[model samples]
Target chain A: MGPVELGDQQMVAIQTRNLSRTFDEVVAVDDLDLEVHTGEVYGFLGPNGAGKSTTINMLLGFVPPSDGSGTVLGHDIATESLALRRRTGVLPEDFGVYDRLTARKHVEFAIETKAADDDPEVLLERVGLADAIDRKAGGFSKGMAQRLALAMALAGDPDLLLLDEPSTGLDPNGAREMRSIIRQEVDRGATVFFSSHILGQVEAICDRVGVLREGRLVAEDTIEGLRSEFDSAARLIVTIDEPTDDIVTAVRSTAGVVDVRIEEADIVVSLERDDRKAPVINAIEDAGGTITDITSADPSLEDLFAALTTDGDGTDLGVSSRNRSPGRPRATEGDA
Target chain B: MTWLHVAKKDFHDAGRSRLLWVLTALLVLLVAGVAAIPYVLAAATNDPTPTFESGLTFLFSPIGFLIPIIGLAVGYRSIVGERESGSIRFLLGLPNSREDVLLGKVVGRTGVVTVPIVIGFAVGGVVIAALYQGFDGLDYLGLLLFTVVMGLVYVAIAVGISASVSTRGKALGLVITVYAVVDWFWTFIPMSLYWILERSFPGFEDLPAWYLLLERLSPGQALSAISLTLIDTFGAGDVDLTAAGRVAGDVPFYLETWFAWVIVLGWIVVPLAVGYLRFRSALLN
Candidate 1:
């Protein structure tokens, strides 16, 4: 191939075509064509054993692809891995720290490995571990350890960042802080590709998401594009002052309403379009229903993920059922 | 090379470990304590003229046993521990190739073995000089250098096994088997072959060049072969200690004492190359 142009490199940060990998008889990642644009937060979403880590491992050359090819930051993923890693940072999944080394030392090792002139203190501070910079990593909590790994990943101000399950062990507040740091990196004009099993975590930050199911790319789209395409039906919960059997019947008869039910004192209206929200509200009011509260309940990425991943038999789509980060609200999932 | 960074980091991390301190203390005691044994023995038997050569001869077996243990102890956990602890992700997550991590472990762990060895010999050298007559400083330094080279060989072997295996138990098992075979039971190979070839147990004298070569092939024997020449004999018993004296006729070049340096060099290079090849293609998934 001729020398790649600068515009082509700037146009795409990561691109993989027909990538496949299998361990013995079990396919880990299959014929996957994945693309992440420069300066975008692309969320690689999947449950446990969905081959998310395997894909990243192949991209980083930790594991070779059984078939096909890929590139990261205009470098071939297989041949130019070290050069790619030099310019791109990675926070790997289930990564452990050197217990003997202090937080600063870990970042220093990364800086030294990259031959970068970054001050270890500044990197550690960026990850919000400045207070524990001098402390041994053995004493750091799980959240603190994750932050330290992030600091090391940030050592060289890399052009692209591959973060695999970056919020795995963090508390709600710790996760928010990490997300903000990610935003800052994005602001620095770095492309960020992060993976997560939990969709709520990426719902706020991801510009686009790709869902992996049984080693296949089931869906890849912008967040809004995903919601509108996969889920034309949205649950609109309308709470009234009194019991609402009449309102439920009235909303069920509305033009775009799919299903309507009186769930306690609230009329749970499933509509075919978001515009149906206004018509359902009008229908309820015409039926003498006094509306006290209205919740649109557009399918959270969680619901969209479930709809795309599960089959009619629900014969194990391989998505994790447990919603982690207990403090995040799951009330939206009740009628979803 | 990136391996240099990995080595520096490995050494820096190992310096903070309790294992290094413990190794240093043990080597100090073994070196100094073994040196004084020859003097104590001569005084008890009323032949109280232990030279530095005699003192080192007394020191050889213990050094042989202790150095390999120190080497294995430092090297066995180098890579496998990172795999088990999941810290290998951090190591390889950076720009380091697998060769870098493997080579770094070898050099870093060799440094770990070197620290206590240099300290132990320094402390033991003073004790040996004061306790024994005819203390040859240059010869003592030769023995010290040979022991450090031996440390590198054992560390290479241990690091090789550490890199090849997936778990700590497998690495430890391979290391123990290797040490036991090379250090203790290597005679079985030559002895069994001799029995098959000549139909009798061979004596020390008039042994075929191949037979002696087989015996010299083990890492422990090959290392001691180099060390034996580095020290002066002092003509105590006028014993024929050279390899030429044991062969049935004129010695072959392979049986020469200098050839053991080649063997020792092979021990250092072969295991590391094998481990690097295996680790290079290893899927860190």
Candidate 2:
């Protein structure tokens, strides 16, 4: 959705208008305009050095933007940063916890920092860290430390949560738990804006995903939307009683059918459009092959993400420009 | 309130460390040892009354060296260590500005370093009262408070270097250079300048009064000047009024003993002010 459309009805959790940050000659984030709506799980996907963290740091006001402006939770990021931080919960990338403090103490410190009245015990228990509550965090494993950090981020039940690489050190099981917690928070009417380099981590939870390439946002849409936009191939698999050359030839000759292959008990046909499935099934039946069952599978999000992130020459999108003006937002056509 | 929360957390973090505790214990022992000197002199000379000047001078000399070490040890990693280890981003992620972090650190570290000085002086004061014949309570309290201010001056310097440097190693090197030049080798500058001028002109006999004023900028020298002014039994009789009338028209205001308090206050404010200006704009990686 456009920022104008969302701004009319619902609040924007984060909106950056022509925000840019530069480090000497290199442009970290370039002429970026981003909008995230409230009460939605927005996935920020990018590779390393894709300006995801820089954009986040700018929104948090940890680093000043070289030009342009932005706002978080209705507060200006440049002029009213402390107000922005007061209502926002952030799990920053490469954030370190005090080694001497215990897990419980870290949560308590967060509670005090945010001026929240919630009990630290409940926050730690929610993150499944109650068993190690009193132990010093210096002895924690990477996964445990991540849990404590997440608990700290969840303090005060903030209106907006900005998690940068939230599952960086989590194992598969821990990552699943983290996702469930993120879902619970979103269900509770909180807006979650999290970034991850891995596509699989966000595909299940994100209501909308914005993919960043180099210093620019290349695409933003729902998972299903991205699939239809990029992936054009669908596969139809038919269980046949017997393999026949007649069936193979007949299926291959159907309209929109790209290729036909016969496995042990199934005959599979790749078609360019879903409407061609009936023709392929009729062709197979006319060839005297008895079909027991039929099923069709669309291209998954993994394929769409790979295709969108990779350029036509099979290289990762490496486009970054130093010539763009600071306060001018670039025009891109993809809706949220 | 955000700065107070941050400062309270920092105070607890530093106060609980075993290294700081060990350093404070050593300082307490050193103060007790200094306090025992008058008793030792009385025992050796078979006289029951030991002069007050000898006791105050011996105690003040070693403290001129120990207080800076304790202060630097407590404050050397206030800011740059956090940046190097990536915890600064975590601190900034909360509802805190960069000014809060720097100022909170100064307050937290100043409190941590003051604990040792206050304890050491308290122990030293007890020993002086029990042993020395003419120990004055009001003068000793004034000296003790001045010592705490002196320790805070070094804490400010250490925190300023911590805030300005990008790496902990670089901050350590710079703070140590500051300690070396200001605390240990401040008088060397004037002596070196006098030797060079004499070799060139052949009749540059006495050091300029302005050089003494320049040396007063060091926190250690400033503390010494204040201590001498408070004690009154030593360093008061050494000013040569007739010799002061020989070369210059009048002495600089900073050269006066009473003006050293201003120099101490400058040491506490200047470094942190300069550092906060740089830290406010520098990018964090």
The best candidate in terms of lDDT? 1
Q: Report the error of model 1 at residue B191, Å.
A: 1.7
lDDT of 2 by residue, B44-129 (tens): 99977775556766777677777798788778898988898777877888888888888889888888877877787788777777
Stretches of model 2 off by over 4 angstroms after superposition: A1-7, A231-298, A313-336, B192-209, B229-252
Query: What is candidate 1's local distance difference test score?
Result: 0.84
Docking class of 2: medium
Q: TM-score (0 to 1) of chain B, per candidate?
A: 0.95, 0.87
- For model 1, residues B157-190, the per-residue Cα lDDT tens digits are 9999889888999999999999999888998899
CAPRI quality band, candidate 1:
medium
* Deviating ranges (above 4 Å) for candidate 1: A1-10, A230-298, A312-336, B233-237
Model 2 lDDT, full chain set: 0.78
Winning candidate number (DockQ): 1
Best by TM-score: 1
Model 1 chain B scores worst on lDDT over the 10 consecutive residues at B232-241
Q: Candidate 2 residues A1-107, lDDT tens each?
A: 22223637977888888889889889988888888988899999877777889999888877899988887888888888888777778888887778888888888
